[model samples]
Target: MFNKLFGKPKAKGKDAKANVKTVATALSSMERINENLDMLEKKEQILQRKIAAELAKATEYSKAKNKRAAINCLKKKKLFEAQAEQLAAYQLRLHDQMILLEGAKATTDTVDALRSSAVAMKAIQKQTKIDDVDRTMEDISEQQDNMKQIQDALTGPVGVASDFDEDELEAELEELEGTDLDEQLHESMSNVPYAQEPIMSSPEAAVPIPAPSKRTPPEKTPVHDRSEDEELAALQKEMAL
Candidate 1:
């Protein structure tokens, strides 16, 4: 995504390896020089001991009255001092050379480190960009939202209509319930026996009932009216009793 933002990396691996190799070589040379300096120091110490021994021999010779032997010993001591001075100069030159090489090695190593760091920074810049990161985050958020919607759709209740009216359904259910109750009441009434009105035994009732007369059948009454009449008859029977 960020390829266009940073371009390609430069070629520097071979150069870095070469610099490291040079530094290694210089460090090795410095180590050898230090070793030589150490050897020179040891030689100087040995020469100092020899000079001391020669002086002691000269003192013994002079005490014994041997002037010629004492003079020869002093000449040998001078020769040893000259050699020690030359060795000291050589050791000093070696120290200088080692110091210079050590400094060069350190410089080379520092340059290599800086170069590696720059390369790493360049590579990182090539692989990332602020705009790309922002776009990617936005895309991730959008995908999450889409996934949530998809999951809701998949897991949502089936066969459940959202467009229907709950109030209407409730009202219809109430109507059905009322109808069922009415039917049950009707069934109960049908199951019960109707009560007969009792005949009164009062003086006002001395007139006998008339004989049956030819009359047309009564018109069919509504079921509710018939039920009401039966209930009224049952009440009347109770009152008569």
Candidate 2:
């Protein structure tokens, strides 16, 4: 009737919950084990002290030559030795458990450290790439500025003015040379006379002069004077006579 009212009792065995609870319990027990180890170490020390005291009592009994006391002291010594051995075994087990737990903890820490390093390396790589891009942009900007400066120098007003001055100087020099040549020619012309005659005369002016002709005397008139001449001769002869 109760089975019918409550349906059926649940079967209890090891389940997921139970397994989790077991692992939790084991971890709790491990903590207790460490505490117990510390307690056992203290107990071991006490047992070692007891064993030494028993040994001293046995030795004193042996020297006293008392058989019953010596036997009792030997029994006490044996009991102390047995307790010490049990404590030593418990300490050995605790040491093994502690060694295993320490190794597991070290391995877990190492894995975590490696994961952290990998994440840091990824961050560093990203930052380095960004820095490189910024540097490249800066370099390009600097180069552009330098090129602009060079272009300005090539096309500036000073450059044009210098070229203009050179051309003007060349033109002035050519004009000066032309003026000097004209002045020299004028000076030479002024120094020489224009009216000087040629050393050799022309052919027409070189003709020779002709000589003068000879003339004859006029003829004498003799008949008219002959009669006069005879009379004059007769007078002259009479006066002489």
Candidate 3:
């Protein structure tokens, strides 16, 4: 349904622009591919010529009985054949890409034509709506101005609330100052230094001690009688005379 309304839904302007860029890139790539193909073709022709020359030289050497030279020429011919096969494969790949690029070119041209028609139709519609667009723009500007004024009225500095009570705040500050003064006075009075008292002597310190008394020696008595001792001795002497 949208395709029917929009005339097959032609490519957007941006898509058309991208398609143009892709076409330019594809063209450049095609040119490089053609150059490569030409180089490959030339290489293939050179290899064919070299192969033919080497085969002829090998045949002549073999006829003359130079086996070593003939074998070297055969090796050269094999190398040329291998190179020619590789170039043929490269040519086939280039042909395939050229066919694909041709198809893409046709599709790009068709899309470009459709986009051109769509752009023309869009330009005509824009011109027809010019008056309506101007009126809408004016209405939007008026609404924006009214919105800005309302926002400013709500958010301005003088519109904000005050959080402090002046009289109550002043009384609280005065009470705090009186308390601080009383604390300072009490601290000063308690911190003053006091005088120290001297120690006194007691009466017990003046008393003297008494000396010890002297002791007398004991007397001794005689153990035997002297008169008895003398009578014994006289009787003994008379007997003897």
lDDT of each: 0.75, 0.66, 0.72
Please provide, for model 1 over 1-241, each residue's C-alpha lDDT reduced to its tens digit, 9 standing for 90 to 100.
1223222233357785676466557656866887899899999999999999999999999999999999999999999999899999999899889778767655665676788789899999999999999999999999999999999999865675766678998999999999999999989866665334344447864434454446643444444566664655444444443
Model 3 alpha-carbon drift over 4 Å, by segment: 1-13, 117-241
Candidate 3's TM-score reads 0.43
- Model 2, global lDDT: 0.66
* Per-model TM-score on C-alpha atoms: 0.49, 0.42, 0.43
Compared with the true structure, what per-residue lDDT tens digits does model 2 show for residues 1-241?
A: 2223223212235543554454445455567777899899899899889888878888898899877888898898899889889989988988898677556544544654576578789988987897798999999999999999999988877745666777788999999999999999988755653223232256853423234325432333343354644534443333333
Which candidate comes out best when scored by lDDT? 1
Backbone clashes for every candidate come to 0, 0, 0
Better of 1 and 2 by TM-score: 1
* Candidate 2: residue pairs that collide: none
Encode model 3's per-residue lDDT on 184-236: one tens digit a residue: 99887546531121111356433232343254322212213335434344433
TM-score of 2: 0.42
Q: What C-alpha lDDT does candidate 1 achieve relative to the native structure?
A: 0.75
- CA RMSD per model (angstroms): 17.3, 35.2, 30.5
RMSD after Cα superposition, model 1: 17.3
Report RMSD for candidate 2. Answer: 35.2
Ranking by TM-score: 1, 3, 2
lDDT of 1 at 239: 40
